[model samples]
Target: MTIKNSGKFIIQKEKLIIYLFVLSVVFADILGNGNLNLLYFFGLFLIFKNLKIQVSFLKDMVIFFVPFCLMILGEIFLSGNTFSPVKVLVYSLKILVCISLLSYTKKRFWVVDHLTIIKNICGLFEIMLVISLLTINKPIFWRLNDVINRFSKTRLKFLYSEPSVLGILCGLLVIILLYYIFDNKKNYMLLKEIVLLAVIILLTFSMSGIVYTAIGIIVLFLFQVFKNKEVIPRRMLTYFLLGICLLIIILSTNNPISNRFFSMFLGTDGSYNFRWSAAVNVFRKTMEITRYWGMGLGNMNTPSGLSFLLNIGIDYKFANSFLYFFTENGILGIIYTIYLFLICTYNCIKSSKNIRPLKVGVLAFAFVSQIAGGYYTDPILWIMYGIVCSNEKTVIN
Candidate 1:
C-alpha cells in the first residue's frame, strides 16, 4: 500500500480503539467481573502505541495519582484495617489508563471534530435504550437488575445494573442534543433527538437526570437569547412550550416517575431520606476521624463504619460524590478535585469562541452529576475534561 493508504489505515485503527473504549465505558457494569479491566488493558495498549513521554504529562499524572497514594498510606497507618495494596494498585492503574487514553484521543482528534464522535456515542446509547425497553420482561435480561430487588417495580436499566446509570447516560445524550440544537440553529433534526432523550430520561425515574435535562435546555435557551441576541422563532417556541407542557402534565400525574421525582422534595421518599442521612453521617464521621487526610481509598464504605451508621439508623452507602470523595481522600481529595474543576472551567472559557456552548453544556452536565453523585469516576466525565482542557487548535470544518 502507498504511504497515504497506510496512514489512513492507522487512523482507522485508532478510531476503532476509541470506539471500543466508549463501548467499554457504556457497558462497564453490565459485562461483569474482570471485563472492564480487560477493556482498560486494551486501551492502555493503544495509548502506549502512540504515547510520547512528555515531562509535563508525566507531572500531571503524578499530581493526579498523589491523592490515591496518600489514601493508601492513610489506610495503612491511620485506619486499623487490612492494608490492601492490590486494591490501591488496581484503582491507580485504572485511573492512569483512563487518563492516558483520554490524552491520546485528544491529541489525535481535534475537539471541534468531536461532534461526530459524540453523535455516534449517543446513537449507541439510544440503541441500548431501545433494547432495554424491549427486553424489560425477558428473563435473560432480568439479571441486570440484580443490584436492586427484583420484586419491586422494574425501572428501565437497559444494559446497566441500575436505573440511575441509564438515566445518567441518557442525560449526557440530552446535553449533547441540546448543544447541537443551540449551537446550530438551522439543525431541525435536533428537536426529535431532544424529545427522544427526554422520553428515555423520564423512563429511568431519576431526579438527577430530570433536573440536569431541564438545566441544559434552560441554559441553552438563555444563552441563545442573551448572548446571541436571537429571537425565539414562533414555531420553534410553540414546540418548546408544548414539550414543557407535556413534561409538566407527566410530572403532575400519579405515576412512578412523577412520584419518584417529586417525592424527594416533599420529604416522603424513604430512599431519598436514607441516602441523605447516610451521606451526612459519612461526611461527619470522616471529618471526625480524618480531619485533613481521608480514612482511605477503600475505607469509604468500610463495614465497621457502615455498621456504626446502621446502628444509628442510617442504613445506606454514601450516595453523594462530594461526600464520598471527602471521606475517601479527605480534604486533599476535595482540593484536588476543585483544582481540576477550575482548570476545566478556565479552559472552557478560554476556548469559548470555538464551540464554546457545547463545552459549557458538557461542563454543566458533569458538574451537576458530580454534585448529585453516581458519576465521580465516569469515563464520559474524564473524556469531557480532556476535551475541554485540550490545547489542540480547533478546525472549523
Candidate 2:
C-alpha cells in the first residue's frame, strides 16, 4: 500500500511540475518575467534521467535530423573545429528533454482537468500581461527587456530580442483563445471570454498574431455557422461588441497597425532587418556548400552578414522559425514535420465526432493553433502535444 501510494505521489508531483514549467514559459515573455522555478529544474532532471532511444520517437526525431546531419557532417569535415552541428545538436537536446517529459507524464496529468488548470493559468497571466502592455507604447523592439533593464533583470524577453518574438507570442495566444472560442458553448460569457482573449493578443503588437487571429476568427465563425445550422445568433453579435471593446483597449495605441504589419514582412527595420538578412544568408551559403545535406545543426545560426553579397535570398528574415526548419532540415524534414501535424490534426478531428461537447471544443482549439502558427518551441509544443495525445485517453480514467 505504501509503494502504491508513493507512486501516485510521484505522478502527481511530476504533473504539477509540468504545469508549472509551461506557465513559466508562457509568462516568460511578459515584462519582468524571468526566474527559474524549482519545478523546471526538477522536472528537467527527471526527464533526462529517463531518456532512451525509443524506436518510434527516434524515427520521428531522426527524420528531421537528416538535414541537420548534413550540416553536422560539413562542419566536421571542413572546419574540423565544428562550431556548427554541435551547437544545433546541443540546442536540440533541450527540446528532446521536453518531448521526453511530455511523453513520460502522458498518463499522469488528467487531460480535461489539466486543461482547466491551463485555462486558469492563462487567466492569471492575462492580468499581468495586460498591465505590462498598458505601461508601454511604441514599437521600440525591446519593451519587455526595457521594462526589465530599467526595472528588473530577467532572461526571458526583457528587451524583446526581436519583434518576431512578440509576433510569435501573439500568434500563440491567439491560437489558445481560438481553441476556447470553438469549444465553449454559445453563451454571453463565452463570447466575452474570447473577445477578452483576443484583446490580450492585440496588446503584443505581433503582426503574426494579428494576421493569425484574423484567419482563425474567420474559420471559427464558419464552424459556428455550419455546426449550428444557418442562424446568426444574438450571442455572436454581443461577442463582436466585446471584441470591439477589447480591440479598443489593446490596439488604440499610437502604434499604427499598418506599420506593425509592415515590420513583420519587411523584418523589423534596422537591427531586426539586418540580423535576419544575415541569418538568411547563412541558409543560402549552406545550400551552396551542401545542397544535398545543407549545413546541418550548428549552422542554424548565421555566418554571413550580407544577403546582397550572397543573394540566395528572399525579402524577409531567413531564420523565421518555420522557414529555418525547412532551410536547415531540408525538404525531408519539412515533410515529416508536416506528416506529424496531419496525423495529430486528423486524430483531433476524428475524436471530436463521438465525444462530448467540451472534448469536441478542445479538439477544435488544437486545430486553429496549428493553422495560425506551426510552431515547434518547447512548453507550447510539448504541452500541446501532451494534451493532443491525451485526447485518446478516457475522460474518466
Candidate 3:
C-alpha cells in the first residue's frame, strides 16, 4: 500500500478494534461462563497483538499495579493463606488485562464521538433483548435461559449470564443515552431508546436496576434545573412526587415487579437479602479478621464467613462490589479504587462542557457498580474510567 493508504488503513483498523473492544465489554458475560470470560481474553489478545506501549500507559499501569501487588503479596505472606498465591495470580492477570484495555482506549479514541458509540450500544442491546424474548424457550445464542419466577415470569437475559446483569447494564445504558440528550431536550429517537431500555430493566425484575434508573432520572432532572437557571426546581419536585405516586400505584398492584419491590423493602427478597444482609456481615467479619490489610485476592472463594451466614456447605463471595473489594484488598485497595474515580471526576471536570454529561453517567455507574453485582475486573467499569480520563481536547459535536 502507498504511505497515505497505509495511514488510512491504520486508522480504520483502530476504529474496528475500538468497536470490538466495546462489544466485548458490554456482552462480556456471555463471552464465557464464570470468571473465565473469553471476551476479556480476546480483548487482551487484541491489545497485545497491536501493542504500542506509551509512557503514559505505563504510568497508569504502575499506579494501579503497585497497590494490587502489595495487597496480594501481603495476604500471601503475612496472612498465611494457603490458596492466596494462586488466586492472587489469577486476579492480577485479570486486573492487568483491564488496565491495558483502559490505557489503549484513552490514548486512541479520546476525541471520538462517544455519543454515537453509546447509541449503537443501546441499539445492540435492544436487538439482543428482542431476540432473547422471542427465543426464550428455544435455547438460542441470545437467550441465556427462560427464567421463571413469581414476579415477571420469563425474564430476559439477552446473551448475558443472568437477568440482573442485563437489567443493571440496561439501567446504566439508559443514563448514558440520556446524557446524549443535549440541552435536556429529548428528541424522539432518544426518548424511544430510553423507554425501551427502561422496559428491559423492568422485565429483568432487577431491584438495583430499578433503583439506579430512578436515581439517574432524578439526577438528570436536577442537573438540567441547575444548568438552566431559568428553569424552576418544580420540574424536579414534580418528578419526585410523580415517582412517589407511581410507587404507590405499583405497590398496590399484585404483580411480580411489585412483589419484588415490596419484598426488597421488607428484607424478604432472597436475592436482596443475600446481597445486603449476608454479604455485609461477611464483609464486616472479614475486615475485622484481616485488620487494615485484607483477606487477599481470591480468598472469598475459600471457606469463609459467607458459608456460615448463608448456611450453605459450599463457599461463596460477596455479590456487592464495594464489599467484595474491601474484604479482599482491604483499606489500601479501597483507597486506590476511590482515587481512580476521583481522577475521572477531576479530568471530566476539566474537559469540554459538551462531555460533562458523561461525568454524571460515570458517577452513576460508579454508584451502581458498588450496589450491583460484579467484581473489580468488570470491563465496563474500567472502560468508563478510561473514557472519562481520555484526552482533555474532546470535541463532542
Candidate 4:
C-alpha cells in the first residue's frame, strides 16, 4: 500500500512539474529576464527528476544533438569563431532539455491529455492578452518599432519582444480554437474564442502569422467541405463570412496593420528584397567555404559580413529557418532534420482520423510558421512535434 501511495505521489508531482514547464514556455517572454532564467533552472531540475536515462533516449538525444554540436564545432574550427561555441552550446541545451521533458511526459500521459495541457497553455496566453489590453497605456505594454529606421511605424507586440513573436503565439491559439470548434460542433464558446484570437493576431500585424493563419483556415474549411460530400455547412459558411467581414473592416482602417500588408511587398520598401538577400548571402557563404559539411553553427553571420547586403545596413544574420539550418549544418544536417520532420508529419497524418483536428492544426501551424518566421529557437514548435508524434492510444494502466 505504501509503495502504491508513493508512486501516485510521484506521478502527481511530475504532472505538476509538466504543467509548470508548459507555463514557462508559453509565458517565457512575459516573465522578464531574471524570472525566466529562474523558471528555466526549475524546469531543468524537474526534467532531471523525471528522466529515466535509457539507451533509446540517449540515442534520440544523440541524433538531435550531434548536428547542433557539429555546427558549433564547424564554426569554431572552420569559421575561426572561438567565442561563438558557448552561445551555441547554451542554445542547444535549452532545446535538449525541452525535448527530454516532453518525451518523458508523453511516455506517462495520454496524447489527448497532452492536447488538453496545450489548450490550457493557450488559455493562459488569452489571460495575458487581457492583461496587456488593460495595461496598454503603460510604457511596458508599448508596441515595438524598428530600431535602425526611426521613422518606421510601430506595430503591436503586446507582452512579447516583437510583433511577429506575438503573432506566432496568437496564430497557434487560433488554430487550436478552430480545431475545438470542428471537434465540438455545439461549442459556441469556441467560435467566439476563435473570433477573438483572429482579431488579436491581426492586431500584431505579423505578415507571417496572417498568411499562415489564412492558409490553415482555408485548409480546415476544405477538409470539412470534402468530408461532408462537397456541401458547405450553413454554420461553417456563416462563420466564414463573419471572419471575412471582420478582416475587411480591419483592413479598411488607416492603421499600421493595414499599412503593413501594402508596404511589406512594395518594391520600394526593400523588406522582401532584404529577406531574399539574407537567404542568398547565407547560402552563398556556406557553399563558398564547405561543400558537403557546414561551416559550424555558432553564428552564420560572417564576422567580415556578407558583400553589399551588410554594407547597405541590412543585418542578414537571421534568415528563414530552413535556410539557416542548411547554412549552419550543411546538406546532411538539413536532410536529417527534414527526415525527423517527415516522420512527425507522417505520424500526424496516420493518426489524424483517430485524433482531433486540433492536433493536426497544431502540426500544420508549427511547420508553416517555423519555415516562414525563422523561429528556430522556439520551444513550442518542438513541443507540438512531440505531441503529434506521441502514441494515439490513451493510457489504460
Candidate 2 lDDT tens digits, 308-327? 23455544434344445545
lDDT of 3 by residue, 153-260 (tens): 566666677776676667766766666553444444777777788878877776666776667656655555465566565545665687689889877988777887
Question: Candidate 3 regions off by >4 Å?
Answer: 1-3, 22-27, 108-110, 139-150, 182-187, 228-253, 303-315, 348-354
lDDT of 1 by residue, 112-225 (tens): 345565566567767876786678777433334433322235555556656666667677767666665655667776666666767777666666677766675565555544
Model 4: worst 10 consecutive residues (lDDT sum): 147-156
Query: In model 2, how large is the Cα lDDT of residue 130?
Result: 55
| lDDT of each residue in 116-161, candidate 4, tens digit only | 6655766766776788777765545457455522223445565565
- Compared with the true structure, all predictions reach lDDT values of 0.63, 0.48, 0.67, 0.61
Checking candidate 1 for backbone clashes, the offending pairs are none
Clash pairs of candidate 3? 151-256
Q: What residue pairs are clashing in model 2?
A: 71-295, 71-296, 84-298, 85-298, 142-160, 144-159, 145-158, 145-159, 179-365, 183-361
TM-score of each candidate? Answer: 0.82, 0.62, 0.83, 0.78
Q: Model 2 off-target regions past 4 Å?
A: 1-15, 26-85, 101-112, 123-174, 186-197, 224-255, 262-289, 302-317, 354-379, 385-389
Give each model's clash number.
Answer: 0, 10, 1, 4
lDDT at residue 116 of model 3 (Cα atoms): 67
lDDT of 1: 0.63
